[model samples]
Target: MRKLFFYTKQQFFNFKAMQTAAGFKLLSMSQLLSSQKVGELNKNQKYYVDLSSVMGYTKTNDSQQMLFEQLFDSFGENIDFICDKMYEEDIKYIFRYIFDDFSDVDAASEEIIAEKETIIETPSRKRRIVDLNDKELDDFFKVFDASLYGHERFKEEFKKLVTAYRVFNKIGEHKILSLFLMGDSGVGKTEVARAIHKALGSRTKLAKVNFGNYSSHDALNSLIGSPLGYIGSDGGELLKRIQESDVGLILIDEFEKADSAVFNYFLDVLENGKVVNSQADEYDVNGYIIVFTSNITKENFRSKVSPELRSRFDYKGMFNLLTDTDKKKYVHFRVNQIISKYKEFVSEDIPDGLHDRVVCEVDVSKYKNMRDLNKKIKDTFVKLIGA
Candidate 1:
């Protein structure tokens, strides 16, 4: 195994240069001379000359007088003169002074390989959603607050949700948090789900299913194969993928739009953390997190979904319309993100005063929330870019 060594300036000099500078090669000779000295060297001199004592080099005591006589005659000045002048104090300069040609070559090669591996390995590790550490989580919320545009109350609610999950995780009970997010259209219901999924860290770790996709007659068959109807159809609709990703996230978009029959089965998974396949075998879903996103308001949802089904979820988050303040912030944030992202596309800075003009001209009354703003921005961009 190769090891990298770190050295302090004083220590490096003591080990690499001081002993070699003086004529003494045996350690005993240097020690006898220091002890027999009429006057002791100061801390600075000792620190400078202590190199020989630490490096295990220098002449022996039997040859000490000869070595001293040799040391005195070997140079224009005494050992003390050399000690007074320490080398220039830069790491690169110090390294060049200490490491040999072969040592330098080996160190450089090791560094190159390490850097190459880091560059090569990073992509495989990056994901759309990254779990946040304490500091990262704080930054994430701050960015999210800015991104959402004017939902200070919503941000507070989000903070509470995050805190709840963290607290639950600490107690070992938050491994699978089933959240039901109900709200009006164009707020941030779906965005919140996507954000949560991203925060968790990987697209592969998240499985998004559209309830509308399950409306067909073959939907059930697609989920779980025919009882005995076909060959090479052993895998059911999304069963294997969901099973394999036990600790992953599952987002059911437009939950209200899904067929009653499909949701009936989902009820079982939500409540019991287990799903029975067509084969009548129960698969454990204890480690899976289920997120249900709907455009319906809580009042309507309360009327639509039964009390029994509502009780299964740990929390029900309400995504309301964005306040005016949120709209301005959101617009500013989005403009900045776009400008920063496509800076190379524009030679001048963001079409000159475009952000302020858009924010001022935007019809806030017509837009209810983030979803509306996002759609308006999307349409506006198409016209602006002529793409």
Candidate 2:
């Protein structure tokens, strides 16, 4: 049986899981080192070490190298190692010097085959709505429509584009459906992604990356990860989130804030339907939906975005603020939903007309931002409940 194991950074897709057993013990490199010093280590115990957290690899230490040799020699079996790709060279050193049987697992092992079959491979996975047939898609759209409170015009345009995309997709003409939504804050822009995620029956959260927090100089590096082999380098947050999600939708929020490097990166992603990280690891995003939401005005959009990049968007729709009537309807729905939850959780009695009372207090015309309207609803509910 193979005794040495290395959990690569790619495997930590926003979630790392392990099962604890009676003989199994999880340790950081430091903890293992401490155990080595005390001579308390037991060969009967299974060891899992997160070697990535060992920062002592700053320079080659002869004592540490000898310790590793002695440590493993003490317990030859049942050892799991983790290496953040930053220290692949060091892990390789250990692999060559210590374990000659296999690198990560036995050559042509079933475990490696299963890992390749599941994680980071696009072909093995099913595309959510893209895999849906005509009748199935129609049903999905209905659920998507009801999930959002407003944006009727954008919804209609989306339905048409999706239908056209489905036909083009079959012929290999269209690789992905792109939506470039321009809007003010709090106008159901990101909600489009959430709705699609829910409608697609994904139990995981929507895959999303917001460029607003990134500076122009470092945006590309952060998006795809810093160039490989850099200290603390790993597969990027974007790819990890995509791997974590079970759906085909990806949301890029605050799109205009990202620099041209990021823009060009995505332009290629849109064109090729494959996201290649700095490490040259490819993630195929074909048959996926990529939604880009930006708050830049029409004038600024034309000025900030290049024409070549502009032409790549399949649908560029401006999301308008909800109408007062729609806002009122939203308030009513929220109130009823909140009251039902309150009843379920708190088991409290409420006035028969409490929903109406809460709804009437929220004046939708006074707030243009749906987020502000939502806050008002919550405040009103709390006040009425306290009364």
Candidate 3:
């Protein structure tokens, strides 16, 4: 009797390695069992069946045993089966009864497969923002405040929003806290979302969708996916962004640029706290905080977005250019960050007071734009470090 081989779950997905070691093509056990006919096999071809998928086919032990016996009898010498480490005695008994010997692949092949265990052991993707423990929550505000400079009024309002969200989350009445920020080109409008993302300790890219690109007639189609039967109708940009993100916070930049259809779509999102794709898949955005940043003035905002939609925003505020004092604070923060990064990476140590030198050289008063100021900081660092 041919010996049956068992493979761990980690080795299943590594098709290349499995093929190389087993000299066979891999097939799912479920697919074979579900199919009405077993196709003819090539003389040299060998097939592997994953037993985990087979276990899901039936519930009872007797049924599983019967299925296993039939599968072994039908496949005969044409196939080998693989399974994750099964501890169940009944399942082991079936394997023992079917085959005379149980064997693993050669040691060299086992080593190659063992190396891939790390890939399998990796934790599943993080979907939502990890809730802060009581101690962490207490310190959250302080970190948040420090990260975002200027906008003291906006900070207080945001704190209130967060407090309300935590309280009302249980009642399920209030779903999402939506903030609409209007400001000039280079003020910290988008920074509000960034600060929150950082405070939440997100290691993933911030979920950002710039509606400026979706200003065309097909704006809604681009934001959410195209309908079925339409070309490229897989999934929408917003849904894709949300899925890729590790946190619940989403930043929609250039909100004023999108058309009416997109606006109405977001209206539903904010009210229902769910984003439904064209495919009708609903993503729960409840307890999420979405920050919408726009460059439109207050007059234009009123004229462009309807009053009904305007009223739905939890907080609407205009972000102003940072005060000189706040600008200096930003300079200090940026300088320290650059210096720390420099110290960590660069081996050459020139001056003890490089941070002070760099900060003093950057003239915050000369630039009103944060982007320009950031450029100045980079320039100053390059000049000082001679990198």
In model 2, the worst 10-residue window by lDDT is 14-23
Tens-place lDDT digits, model 1, residues 323-386: 7766766665565445434553664344555555555656666788566676787666545544
lDDT agreement of model 1 with the native = 0.51
User: What is the lDDT, from 0 to 100, of the residue 258 in candidate 1?
Assistant: 56
Candidate 1 stretches with Cα past 4 Å from truth are: 1-136, 139-146, 166-175, 203-206, 216-237, 240-247, 274-288, 344-350, 382-387
Predictions in order: lDDT: 0.51, 0.73, 0.72
Off by over 4 Å in 3: 1-130
Candidate 1's TM-score = 0.56
The most accurate candidate by TM-score is 2
Estimate, for each residue in 2-42, the C-alpha lDDT of model 2 and write its tens digit: 33454454444311321121123455676656545435543
Q: Kindly indicate the candidate among 1 and 3 with the higher lDDT.
A: 3
Which window of ten consecutive residues has the lowest lDDT sum in model 1?
A: 99-108
Best by lDDT: 2
Model 2 per-residue lDDT at 38: 30
